[model samples]
Target: MDRLSTRFKGTKTYLTNAALEASVNCALVLEKPLLVRGEPGTGKTLLAEAIAEALDMELITWHIKSTSRAQDGLYVYDTVQRLYDSRFGEGNVHDIRNYIRLGPLGGAFTADKRKVLLIDEIDKADIEFPNDLLHELDRMQFKIIETNEEIKAKYRPVVIITSNAEKELGDAFLRRCVFHFIDFPDRELMERIVKVHHPDIDERLVNQAIETFYQIRAMQRMRKPPSTSELVDWIAVLKSAGVTNTQLDQNLPFLGTLLKKEQDLVTYADQLAGGRRWRS
Candidate 1:
């Protein structure tokens, strides 16, 4: 049982949380999909890529959309294209595989070697999509209806499924997966993350920026608190603009970098202006 902590240390992205490390390792050992629920910018999707890089495995990613279907991850039959080809004599109309495009799940299953599969933002898909994936995920095989062929896994893929928790997942679907929730990193962890991207940044500037970052996050009225990535971006912008500690108070123009929502910006501006309380 290789601990993810040891394996993932050399990866580009750093996740120091002990519980998250354990969950990843457990999922790998059990050969079950890891269901990762987290805030939007908590690196849930990046975990899969980092694992693949660390383990030297190929990464297959399926980014789910609201319109995405479970079968879209497995395969998509181009019936209309086949019909058009048949009329125009463009491609092989008789061969079913010609029209069948192998999707992320299908590619992972049929690969000669084990790979890492990232099903990102699974909650974006329809409610039934997760349930629809249960059988194939359990068996590591999927049947291609048009070709009447079964594609089985040559090696069990390392599956990492991420969700933002926009909707509740079905109990039956959740039962089959090893789950982990990634909370926002603490101040120390956040500093390390920021430093990873900005090694040469001034300590004073970093401290001041981080202090302000958390202050904004701690505010009760913020509709969308800045995430780790935004903090990194804000720091990068500050560094590029040669922002100094003394300049921090006078020039908070980069609030746009940290705050995404217009409402958040307006409220924070009010706070800066010494307004009694947040408006909306």
Candidate 2:
């Protein structure tokens, strides 16, 4: 545990826990991708950046979208470019490799040194997307049919994949990964995280703000609950305004920083008007 801690501790802005540490180390040892699922504001995407910083490896990110195809991650043969080159009598139109471009995964595989590959928001793509890359991920090799060239990983990259659970991933795809769920942190953990971000914050203000924050989260009618990042920003605003614990007790200033949605803000206002208090 201590050995793994030394290798992949979180960065100055990032905070990690025991479960995340174990899962990351397990993935590193087994050479499997770490599949992380959490809410949007959680540090799911940041985990890859932290790992790359800790391990001193280059970070390669593939931002998946609704129209993203798994094949695009491996290689793209630009037929349009080739046809244009041929028509215009440009150099090396006969060489198909000239138009071949390596994508993030392909670049990671061909790199001389190992890299940290982050496939962000896999669930944003089509349902078949995860299954499409199964063979290449499993074998760590891909073939470019146009150039009759096969590329293999010089060193297997440390892969980290994140999902917001917007869509269900395939069972076969799940079987190949080391899965970990990052639950929202509890009060103690939240305090530690807040301290990491804002070390000089007054203790009393931190306590009162966290208490109020949790109280807001506990509200049943909230459409979108404030997240960790929101709380951090809220505290920063309070500190800058020289808000005291007593002032926080009376009312939350800069409420926009914490509650983003109109419906949520309206709900909070209604609750406050109904004599709902900030503290239990």
Candidate 3:
């Protein structure tokens, strides 16, 4: 193994390519966030977990959604809770610090040891969301508005952001990141990944199943192709059903495990009737 591979050999459950390893190394050395883009199920979110495991650091994840705001990653003032407390005279309501709550980013910043922060599906938020984070991410510090307290990182955490390309990110945000797009794994890489999950799987079954899996994915009409996770699940189903290598292509046993969409199933069945129409 080369230096990069040796350094980030990936966890037993997660495997990475040279380009991805190099990109991660670049981001670490440059002290910049690594922006990862790929199709859903390409293991984009899992990459952060693997990094944290490999480096023996804590992992903090901020899952972004349509309603997510950039400031939510840093802090949130619990004004409602404070109001309820003040009405009930439950505690000291005069101190605004009592209502201040640190978010994932803030927790990472205040941690004594280095951590890994995964900002998953950043593109799900508004287009300006990424831009709004530029200042704090760049400076590795932020001011808590409620408490007027300055929170700075004791150790800069490894930041990894994932995007499913739901929306276009800003140019400025893109510039600040060490970007890498994770291509879907090819057959060879997929085999290795499968073996990681199913070490005791039969060799012939593995070969036949992989060939069939690729055949299903090759269907241009498929709305959502089966991903790596689905393939692993399908393999487990096959093993449980006592399926043999020769039985795989005969009727595509346990088709539901591989093809999730109804339309895709209909398409495959039609194609099968037309003498394996997916072959091209």
Please name the candidate that would achieve the greatest lDDT relative to the true structure.
2
Model 3: per-residue Cα lDDT over 141-253, one tens digit each: 99997677999998888899999988999898899999999998999999999899899999889988888888888867788898887888989998988888534353778
Which runs of model 3 end up more than 4 angstroms from their true locations? Answer: 1-6, 246-250, 275-280
lDDT (tens digit, per residue) of candidate 1 on 181-225: 888999998988888888888999988889988888887778889
Q: What would the TM-score be for candidate 1 when compared with the true structure?
A: 0.91
- List runs of model 2 lying over 4 Å from the truth: 1-7, 245-251, 273-280
Query: lDDT of model 1 at residue 116?
Result: 94
Candidate 1 — worst ten consecutive residues by lDDT sum? 1-10
- For residue 70, model 2's alpha carbon misses the true position, in angstroms, by 0.8
What is each predicted model's overall lDDT from 0 to 1? 0.85, 0.88, 0.87
Lowest summed-lDDT stretch of 10 residues in model 3? 1-10
